[model samples]
Target: MKKKITVILKKNLVNLGSVGSIVKVSSGYAFNYLIPYNFAQLATVGRVRHYNMFLSIKQKKLNEIQSKLQIISQKLNKITKISVKKKIGNNNQIFGSVSDKEIILNLFDITGEKLDKKHLYFPDIKKIGIYNLDITLASDIKLNIKLQILPAFI
Candidate 1:
């Protein structure tokens, strides 16, 4: 039986491993592609120790970020509904549809935190009474808010 060669990855490789990870691969593949591309190096005792330390630090930072996002999500959940006034026509149809930009602005006003409009998920709000919007704060964190469309006061 051939022994697998262990390597420490210097960069993230698809289907291989993440950065700072130790993985075992065929010697031919490691020497031909990974080593040549500077994506990984041989897993030495010192390198393995360093990788473990690096992973611990990375995990700590991730936990801090997750905690901060969790606090923001809690604050966002406190908001029951975001009221947006729009011009209404004869049949109670709004003149214009709500956009992500507008929603982000309103969210900032309510939460005092600015969020990227790209993270908001909602359908086309042409004529809305009340709709739910999903806000992705992080890959694992999400918050839902109610959007209340009200008729504009003339």
Candidate 2:
């Protein structure tokens, strides 16, 4: 039976792992095909340390982004309600339904934070009244806020 050896892949291979992934393969395959083609490197102690350092730096950057998003979520939740004005047409219906883009813009105006459409959840708003909005900033940060729709001063 052939011996198995460990390697760190430099590129994605079919039926194999992606780049930066450590995997085990036959010794002959590692020496003849993978290493010669510059597709992978043996997981020496120094190279393993380098990979760990890279992951550490990546984790730090991710933490910083999450903290910023948490702050923005807190700011959004502190407000009791937000008011939006629209021209009340016949039957007290808006010209059209309020969309996610409009809500994101209003939040940006209030909190100075840009919001993505995928993270904001609410019902299709047509008639002007009060409704609830749900915002997800990160995996752990969520917000529920009141939204008040009123007639525009014209």
Q: What TM-score would each prediction reach against the true structure?
A: 0.77, 0.78
The parts of candidate 1 lying over 4 Å away from their true place are 1-5, 10-19, 24-34, 37-39
Model 1 residue 102 CA deviation (Å) reads 1.7
- The top-ranked prediction according to lDDT is 2
Scored against the true structure, residue 153 in model 2 reaches a CA lDDT of 67
**lDDT, residue 11, model 2:** 97
Locate the minimum summed-lDDT window of 10 residues in model 2: 73-82
Candidate 1 lDDT, tens digit per residue, 1-154? 3467999989999999788778999998889899999999999899899888988998999999889889888889899889888888877788879888888889889899888887899888778499988989898888888899889969
Clashes per candidate, residues 3 or more apart or on different chains: 0, 0
Error of 2 at 55 (Å): 0.8
Give the Cα error of residue 141 in candidate 2, in Å.
Answer: 1.5
**TM-score of model 1 relative to the true fold?**
0.77
